[model samples]
Target: MAKPPPQPPQEPPQGGFGAPQDPRSGSTDGPSGYGYPPKQPSGQPGYGYPQPQGHAPQTPPPPGAAPGYGYPGPPQPGYGYPGRQPYGQQPYGQQPYGMYPQGTYPGGIPPQGGRSNQRMMIVISAAVAVVLVIAGGVWFANSNDGGKDDVAGTSGGSRGSEDGGGTDPTEGGGERPADADAKAVLQVPYPSSVPVDSMLVPGQWATAKTYAKPSVYSITGYHADTGKKAWKLPLDGQVCASSRHVTADGRTAVVFQERKMSSDSSSEPCNQIAVIDLDAGRKLWQKKLPGDRVYSTGLSLTISGNTVASAWIGGSAGYSITGKELWKSASYRGCRPRGYGGGKALVAVTDCGSGIDNEYKVQKIDPATGRAKWSFAAPKGLKNVNVISTDPVVVAVGAGSVSTTDIMSLDDKGKLRARLSLERPEHGQPKYDPNCRIDTESCVTVAVDKDNLYLPSEEHQGKSQYGDTNEIIAFDLGTGKPKWKSDAGEKRTILPLRMDGDTLIAYRQPTLDSGGQVVGIETGSGKQTVYLRLPNETSESERRLAPGYGTGALYVNGRLFMSRDSIRKNSTYDKELALAFGS
Candidate 1:
C-alpha cells in the first residue's frame, strides 16, 4: 500500500530565536549524513547512516549490495547548512508570512515533515560547490564515443554572449598560462554581531573589471584581479534577494526591506526593489511594491532581456530595466505565480490548487507583453518545481515519492520532449544530484547546452579504501538517454559551472595535498584541460569556499569567485564571506 503524504513541520518562530536543530546528524561522533564518508570497521558507525530523533540508528548498506528502493526524505543540508527556520513550514505555494514576513527564504531545502522515511538519499556535501575527496586521478578518461548526435546551434556560444555582455577576459586571450599560480586575490570578512541564524545575502556577479558580492545591508564591488574595494552601495535595510541576471552593460536588481529592522519587536516589509549599476556601484532606481501584507511571505526575482520580474505567493509583477511597471498578475485559475526562471528566456512557475491536488504550470511568458507564449502543465501530485534552464526549458519536479524525481525537457511549443528519471529501479533511490535548492531557477550542479544536459553522478566509494569520487555525465535532451560519462579522475569530483563556447567549464574539488582546479571539457571530443590551479597552501580555504548546492560561484577570465549564498553569525572558517582565486 502507498504511504500517506508526510505532514509539514510546524511554523518556526520569527526573529531567529526559535531556530530548529540541524536534524541531520546520525551518531554522536559527528555529522555522518551527507557526503560520502569513509567506511569504518564493523563495530564503528559509518557514513550515510541517518537515524531519526529517538529512533534506532541506521547503518550503511553492505558493499556491492543491491540498494533498496525507497523515496527521498527531506533535503539534507550540504555545506554551511542554513538553520531550519527559513527553509521549512511554508512548503511551496502558501503565503505563510504577509508583507512583513520575517524569516521565510528560498535557495535550499523545503521544510521536512515529522515522520521519517526509511529511505535515504545519498548526497554529497551541500556546498554551492560540489566536493569529492579522492587521490588518484590526473585526467578524465576520455571516450571516443560520447554523444553521437551532438546538437549544433549558437545558444551555447561564447561565454560573454550567453551571460549578457561585458568584456571577455579570455576573448582575444587564450587560456591562462599553464604555470599560472593561483593565490587568494580577494577575501571579505563576515559581518560582526549577526544573530546566530540564517540571513539572506544572496547575490554574486562578475564583470571584466569587477566582482560584486552582497553583505548584510549593502553590496560591494572589488577589483577583479586585486583585492581592493572599488565601491560600496548601501541600502536602507537588509538585502532579501538578488537577481542572478545582469544587463549587457552591467546592471542588475535586488529586493530589500523598506526600513532597517532595529530590534526584535520591530519588523520590515521586503517590498522595496531597486536596480543598481554593478560597474559604477550605485543605485540606478528604486520603487515600492503594491499590496504587500504585514504577514505575507515568499518572493523570487529574475531578469530576461529588458524585463525584471518579481513573484510572490499572492501575485507577480514585471518592470522595465529602468524601473517602469510592465504588468501585474494576481490569482488566476485558482493559482498564483510563485516564482520565475529568466535569462535567454522568461518562464514562470505557478502553483495551483492545494493539498494532494496541488499542480504546477510552467509558462513561457512574453517578456514585454506578459502573455503566455506557451504553457506546460506539470504532472499532478508534485510538491516543488525548480527551473534548471530557461533557454532549453528544462524543469526539475518532485512528486509524492522523491524530492526531485524527474527532469522534464520541453520543446519550443511547450510540449514535453523528454523526461529523465532521477530515481531508476536499477539504482534503487535517486543517484544524481542536480543540486537545486527551494528557489526556482537555483539548480547549480546541472547545466544545459544546445543538445545535452550535464550532471554529476552521486559520490560513492572509489577505488581507494578511504576515498570517494563521482563523475560528470551527459544526456541527450531530446531522447532522455545517456550520451557519455566523464569520470572525475581518481580522487576528485567535477561539476559543471557553465558552457564556454563548445567547452563545458567545470570545477574539480581539491584533494588533501593539492588545491582545486578549473578545467575546460570539450563537449565534442571529451577532452579536459586544466585552466587554473590554485597553490597547495590555499587548498583548505578552497574546499570551504567552493560553490555547490547552497552557495554561488563565478568563473570569469581566469579568475574564479566563490561566496556564501546566506550568512549566519557562528561560521567558524575564518568568518570569510567571499574569496577570489587567480594568478
Candidate 2:
C-alpha cells in the first residue's frame, strides 16, 4: 500500500452545531495517521472505551483473562471508538470548518455502514514538490513488494460523511414526480426508540435497540415497508449490537453483547455473542467468547455466507450461524486481526511495523477454522496496509507518505486488477465530485456493479488537484479497461448515493453551489433522467448547512427514505432524526 494522499475533511466542522462553510478545498493537514492505543488489562477498561453515561469518564479492560492472543498493539489515530464523538480533535475523515483551496475526497471516509478501522498497512509514497503531484494517465500495476512511507493511511478509520436531502413524491422535474411536501409522514413520528442503527432484511426492517449499558439493549423486528412494529427481542447484558448485514439467507442474525460493569469497575465492551432466528424472533444460541479479546464496535461484525467473523483487540473470532465457536486466533508478535470481509475470508494485519521501511503482510484467514487462506505481502515499500472492503471487491490502500497515495483494487479472486496514484501539487486534499460519504468510499466512491466498475476521473489539469476537470470512468470489473467516459457535469457536481438498476441515485449539488438536489442518472449513457429539488431541506436549523450536511437516504422496498436532523424541541441544535419519504 502507498501512503494515503491528503484528502479534504468529509465535511466542515465534522458534526455538531456550526455555521455554514465554504469547505470545497483540499489539504494535507487532516488527522495524523497510524497511532494505535496500548493493550488494555482484561479487568480494566482500555482506550476507546465509551464512557458510561452518568458514570466516570474513562474505563479499563476486563478481569481474570487467559493469555491474550496476537499483537493487539495500540490503536492507530486515524479513526475513533464508537458511541462517542472525537470532540475538539480532528480525525481522518473530519477537518475543521475550512482548509485549502483544491480538493478531491475519495478514500478515507467509509460508506455509511462501513465502520471498522483496523488493518495492517502496506504504505508507499513518491513525490518531489511543495506538494506531491501525479499524472492520472499512468496506470499502475500491483506489486508484491514496495517501500513504506510515514504513518498516514489513505482510508484508515476516519468516520464522518455527507448527508443526503431528498424530498417527498411531489417535487419533481420535467415528467418526474415531486421530491417532497415534507420530510416525514407527518401523521406518525419516529418512536422514542429512535434507531441508532438500521438494516433492511427480507420482508422486514431489523433495528437494534440503542446501547444503554447498565440498563438494557435489544433487537427489534419491524413490519416491512412500514413503521409498524413487529417483534422486540431483548437481551440481558451490559451492552448490545448487531451486524450491519444479516446472513445471506436473511434468516439468522448475529449480535455481540457484554456483561455489565460494576459502577467502580472497568467499562468492558460487548463480549457475549448471540445468534437469533429472525423468523421465530428467538435466540437460537448464545455464548461468551474466550479470553479478553474485545470487538472494537458495531463495525467489527461481518457476515460471509452462513459464517460471521469479528475482529478484536486480543485477536479475531469466527462463528457458525448457530452460534457455535468456529475458531479464535490469538493476537501476538505484532500480528493481529484488523477486520474481515470479501464474503469468504477474514483479512488481518500480521505486522505492526513503524516508520517508512517496515515490512507488512495482509493475511487472509478462513473464518471457519482460523487457518491462513493466503497472503498479500508488502512489495518492500508499503506498510500500514489497511484492507477496507472485501465482498464485491478487495480494496486495499498503502501510503507512500502523508501527501502521496497508491490505491490498489483487487477482484473477488484476490487478483490485483488496477492500481491508481492520487496526489495534489500543494498537498491539497482530494475532493470527490460524487462526494462520497466517509463510510462508503471503498466500494461506493468507485462503485463495482456486476461486470463493471465506475470511478471518478480527475486530473491536475493545469496545476491544482481540486478536480477542476471531472469525468466518470467506467471500467471492465476484472480487466480494468476504459469502457466509456462520461462528463460528470461541467461546474455542477454529482454525489452518487447508490446504484439503482441501470440508474444511479445521486445528490446533485446545486449548480450555483448553494443548494442541493436529488436526481437519477442512467449509468449506460450517464444522462440525467429523474430529478427532484428538495424544497423542504432548509429547515429552521438547517438554513446554513454545507452541501453534504443535514441529509441521508436509503432505498428500502420502493421508498427512498431520506433522513435529516429535525430540530429537537427546546434544544439549541437541530439533532433529531427526521426522515422524508420520496419516490
RMSD per candidate (Å) reads 16.7, 15.6
Weakest 10 consecutive residues of candidate 2 by summed lDDT: 49-58
> TM-scores of all models?
0.71, 0.54
Candidate 2: lDDT of 372?
A: 51
lDDT by residue (1-583, candidate 1, tens digit) is 8533222212211111111112354332211121121211111222232211100001112233222212223334333222221111111211111111112221222222210011112232221211123233111111111111211110121111122232222122224545566888998877776642345577688777788998877899999879899999888876767788777778888888787666522346677889988889999999887554311235688888767888765566777787777776544446666678887787878666553345567877766655565667665545568888787888987543234556778777776666666643432244565766557767777778778888776665568644456677777786555656666666676777777667787888777667778888777645677888877776655655565534667787778888876565444433467888887
Q: Please give, for residues 1-583, the per-residue lDDT of candidate 2 as tens digits.
A: 7433223223221111111121333321221122111211111222222111000111332343211111112223344233322111112222210011111111111111111111111111212112222222221222332223211111122111111111111112113344432232211222343222211111112222211101124555544334444567776543333343444334344444464334422345556766665545677778765556453221244555556566544555667666666666544444445445434344544444432234545555555555554555433433234443344444434333221133445544444444443333233233222222211121233444555555554321323333233445554544444555544344433445545455556544333333344556555656554455544443322222222322334433333333331211122232323333333
Provide the lDDT at 497 for model 2. 51
The candidate that achieves the highest lDDT relative to the unseen native structure: 1
- What alpha-carbon RMSD in Å does predicted model 2 have with respect to the real structure? 15.6
lDDT of 2: 0.36
